[model samples]
Target: MTTPLRSLFDFNGGVKPDYHKDASTRLSIGVLSAPTEVPTELVIPLHQSIGGTPRPIVAVGEQVKKGQRIGDADGDVSSAVHASTSGTVSAIEMRRMPHPSGLSSLCVVLETDGRDEWIACQAFDHKLATPQEIRDYLRDCGVVGLGGAVFPTHLKLNADRQGGIETLIINGAECEPYITCDDMLMRERANDIVRGVVLMREILGAKQVRIGIEDNKPEAIAAMQVAVGDCGDDLQVVVVPTRYPAGGAKQLIRVITGIEVPHGKRSIDYDVQCFNVATALAIYEAIGLGRPLISRIVTVAGNVDAPRNFDVLIGTPIKKIIAACSPLPDTNRLIMGGPMMGVEMPGDEVPVVKATNCILLGSNKIFPPPAPEMPCIRCGECALACPADLQPLELYWFSRAKIFGKAQEYHLFDCIECGCCSYVCPSNIPLVDYYRFAKSEIWAREKEKSLADEARDRFEFRQFRDVRDEQEKSARLAARAAAAAAAKQLATTDTVAIPNTEASTEANEKAALIAAAIARAREQQVTATPQNMQQLSAEQLAEISAIEARRAEIREQAKPHLPPDA
Candidate 1:
């Protein structure tokens, strides 16, 4: 191993709780016996990573081999899920998840066939493969942060903005009480962990590597040091102080490099990144052995006769391990992590997931309920104990009043929810609970606002479309009206433009000659008829009148029924 650094830095605040890991670390990692005769089923959830949830590819009643891919990664930021043991998929339905919320999630229930078989698997040469190929292989093999964050490992293998990773920190502190999975992994599989670390360093182009383990685990530190022997001058094992949350990625980075990464910023931005020891082992197994992550080391301690670490299969029931650990009669509750940061599981039958690191069984004596939450006295102890170095009292007040904006202004998101402030609060206040509540409310409001904004945008677009359509319709109608008017005007102009025809002139000349002839006839009758009819008496005149009336009727009947122009 390289020479250790002489100086170490300290994070602002942290609490040293009683590390109950001694009981679990007493024995080496034990393997759970496979179900050979008994009918046991494993309920594995597909949504196990920090980003997109995977989609199940295996159907119900399908036969799946151990380490066979059951769920495919959904998108760029997801991890695949594999079957833990050779089994036939009996049912694919919603099952109770191993979360504090007691919510149900989609799961594949595989009934073991007692044949722990495997599909084809071939190791790959990482040195020859491209960087993208290595990352894709790890993602498909279900490699993730096994330290409980469950962040997909492939996504974290990228280079920083500065172009390369400067320091790669491996977290072996296992600072949480009652959790010995990482410690046991480092002690037993230190060589594999180093191989994974070297692989990561090669991919990231890191200049140096630092494996930070708490001074409390002498065995792990010694094992890691020997495994890292002369790998390179840049790789070294540095023992950090035995402090609570020293295993925190940020805290460990600060302790090793004295670079305090701000909230909402990534460690990679500072050319440093961190991973868990178990995660490194999983990575090596994926690349070196071509074996996907189908199982993990889990610590079962607290209120149990045999508090031991077991290499348990994924999707194993919590009750199975509890039964093996011999849970005391007084064990009344099951928590899936250390007391300080673990969560109370919904029930004992809940299936294990990738995020589960430890199963801390609890009883009334082990973890009694906290004293009634008293009003904040502003004693300032919580601030001093906070590793994030934020004022806990002010945050509590803002959260209690439901002033989420104020809480955010106070940098509430920086709180890692490590529970140090709550542990040291003299007012017996559950400050972490308040912070979580505020955060949830804020998220809900943001989601609602987004939905409202989207709906409004859609509505506005519809209105604009309607107005445009109406204008188009009006323009079409006006065009038709103008076309009709133009046609009428064109007809009138054509009539005026036409020259006079010969037939029209003949009809006009005939009408004029008829009118002149009638006028001359009337003048001759008035002058010459009086001399011939001087001696004619009244009887002759009467007879003439009767003949004239009959002649007038005949002439009117004989005349043609036509207009003067025709």
Candidate 2:
């Protein structure tokens, strides 16, 4: 009897293109020699993965070795970066990078010394390390998905253990056209890849390990089967049907295990964790040899005299790789990865980063200029091809209208920009491009909202301070009034008693002196100028006499309270 259809969920809507695998799959991967004209500058971007950017550790003019830690992972999600070669840091500044928009990114530049010496490194015993320890070690080694995603591998491995992950899915399906680095690795280093898979199984405590390879590469499948012959029944090698994007973690998981990772959910939720074959091999290199991820296998193809796969060091310029391949006569478009998901390079100055898997130097003869884009006809072809099961036409309309909120209602964020919809569209409309536009608009609005929230917080804090100050001022005033009232009451209650004999004698003498002085002053004033006397009205003269009389009375009263000597 024939074997059952291997792939469980045969999701429809994928293109069958001329996969030029023979270009690099047949040739053994060769180690690229360091260029004689070593670049004085190396632009190493900080954000080489999906999570937080690594923090740079080296300063300008600092000397470093090939494996020296130039940048460190800031958090559990981030990945570290090691020096690709022994060199002095030339500059740490922003430069053009390998991105779709050709945006500038902060990069670390190095001037090579041609020594290629390694720094002191340490290897950890995988058997002795705890799950957390293994995760941290892998992160420090800068192990990310060698597949185009560049997701931190440690983050995927350290997913919730309580979820009870039972299966480890190893993706060996190099489905992208004109890419064969994974195929070469599987054919040559199957044993190392299996060892890496075993190590991951041990770290995750998985029950079964399933190695999925496309049927197109029978040689790789047979090679891997022989390598894992004695690995026991727990490790099984299965041949899956050849399908584009079958290597996607979610798609591969669904195809092999019939379990779909829910929207906004992880593969661990389905009791499965997927890892790339290259990533597995890198893990083996990291744990077994104590070597950090400073280089990777790159497939250089497309319109060249010779197409080959090379284990190229990180930070090697794209121009150098093309020159090594013997420059193409008619270069049309140069992309850093597969044409399906790769980005076009503005120039050849951009360096090969950790995510650089394949470099395609397309010629005009091989890849003709794309036809002019026409308006969408709303034929629903894009929606049918969307792997995420989204309405691409609606998203396209909302995105063109700049209505990001409405676009999000239809799950704009879920679009992976796989270009499957655009590929299948009859009108040749760039549907994924519209989705990207909506996503960026939403992100910009969110950033603005965050700034507004901060400003509001500062205003509220200022108002609170003003209210506190006013309350404190009122409290101080009340305290001062209470103290003054208490002092007044004390003064009124505490009185001095006067002796009767001394009081009478003191009063009599003061009255006599005052009477005599008043009589003399009155006589002198009457004989003086009549003008001065006339200037004083009847009310003024009466008021002055009353003040003089009151002063004499006060003196008489105080004399009784004074001592006998006074």
Candidate 3:
């Protein structure tokens, strides 16, 4: 077994609040009960992870089996999309995404056949595969961090540029209130988690492995300890203090590894890398069973009769998942994640995806609407509770005034939107909301600037090309003129050197022919002038008027057959 860590480090700024984890973790994870009116359609968003959205591989009307690959990774930093259940591809179109903005994106609609059949998967022993081969296999398996970030796991594994990792920290802290998916996974599948940790250790070539779980989860810590006993002396379970936002990657990393991840830098840059417990479990399944990630255990809690966790398929509708919990009659809001970081769903029809860990049903009684935001009193409670050590009041002032540059200057992008600041604010100011707005505004302006730069570049290039073309045209004309002059000079020189009677006669004949041709062309050309009009007689003018009248009549007659104006 891995020797236990002799000591641990600590980070600054955190709060203690009601965990409410027991409501869901009291029971074991179970499969979701199919609703009486099972949803016939499932909208599977391709861009669930943090990179390029997976490209659709299956077309409409194509039959797909459970765990079948439906969308392929589009880039190195992307994850694959799989069929959560056997169904026929009905539509691949834009649908509302699960975000606060409620924007639309490309989603694969599957009409369930209700068979839930499985497609054959090529499960390989990860121990037998090379590290590179295993990484590629995990990428195909659609493995990603299930700790709400949903970042691709393959990219995280490959972040170690020097191939020398000091520690691999597994974040099992689950510090967010009402989130126990990781807590339960650690308790029930500790051995599997340990197995995944061992695999990660081997792949990363790290000297030590640390799984940090909060002290509130005594059972999970105990189970993980027992599991680690069976492994070698390279892995241990580090029980961290129970605090809100302690589960954050940076905070947990600092507490477990004594390393501070500098702003704009990654944890891997400091000789360490982190993964969630659920992510490690996914890695283990993908490597050990050759199974692609199709589903996850989601915790459904708050304002429900039976609040519990269920093994939910990825594309199952949120309405159906909540049906299992029997929401209270007063339930009005359905949040897709925990209260701190969760986004309220536009409707129940939104489907579950990789990042969905909790579906919280909030009633007026459970989560009453926030009190009218009071003016900030500069109490400094928000700053004291902020895990990132940022000034929430200052950010609020800047964001409220739309002074985005000032907000950014205070390191606005570093705010994790963890809700710690908003939670402790005595003024009930929606501090996190302001931060989010500021960040989004900054990003929008940056995007606009980028687009403007691109347009300017294209316009400048066009101008350059036009000037270049004009210069080339002028050079070509000048060269042709010079050639003609040179030819004339050569002919003069030849004529001066040798004068023959036959040549002179030929030249005179050519000159006479050219003059006659020019005179004939001038005589045949028609020119309009007042002198020619005045020369016309009265009879000729009358004839011209008659011709104009006939032309106008013809034009009137052709109006019906003419094409309409654009």
Summed backbone clashes in each candidate are 0, 0, 4
How many clashing residue pairs, candidate 3?
4
Please give the ranking of all candidate structures by lDDT, highest first, separated by commas.
1, 3, 2
TM-score of each: 0.83, 0.81, 0.84
Model 2: clashing residue pairs? none
Global CA lDDT computed for model 2:
0.81
lDDT of each: 0.87, 0.81, 0.85
Worst 10 residues of 1 by lDDT: 504-513
Candidate 2 per-residue lDDT over residues 1-566, each given as its tens digit:
11235545765455666788897776788776365545555667777888888999999999998878788998988899888888899988887888877888888888888877788767779787777888888899999999888999998886348644788999998888899988888899998898888888877878878888888898899888877885544687878888776777777888888886767888887789899999999998898878889888899999787888888777777777777777578887788888777778888888888899999988777777767888888999877777677898999999989988899898888777777887788887877778777898899999999999999999999999999999999898667555544454455456833334856535544554466569899999888865665777899999988998999999898875758697
Best by lDDT: 1
Whole-model alpha-carbon lDDT for candidate 3: 0.85
Candidate with better lDDT, 2 vs 3: 3
Q: Write the per-residue lDDT of candidate 3 for residues 453-566, one digit (tens) a residue.
A: 999999999999999999999998667555554454466675655345766645644554566568778876644344667888899999988998999999999887746763
Q: What is the per-residue lDDT of model 1 for residues 78-188, given as tens digits with 9 covering 90 to 100?
A: 999999989899998999999889999999999998888888888878778776787788889999999898999999976333556889999998898889998898899
Task: State, as a TM-score between 0 and 1, how close model 1 is to the true structure.
Answer: 0.83
TM-score of 3: 0.84
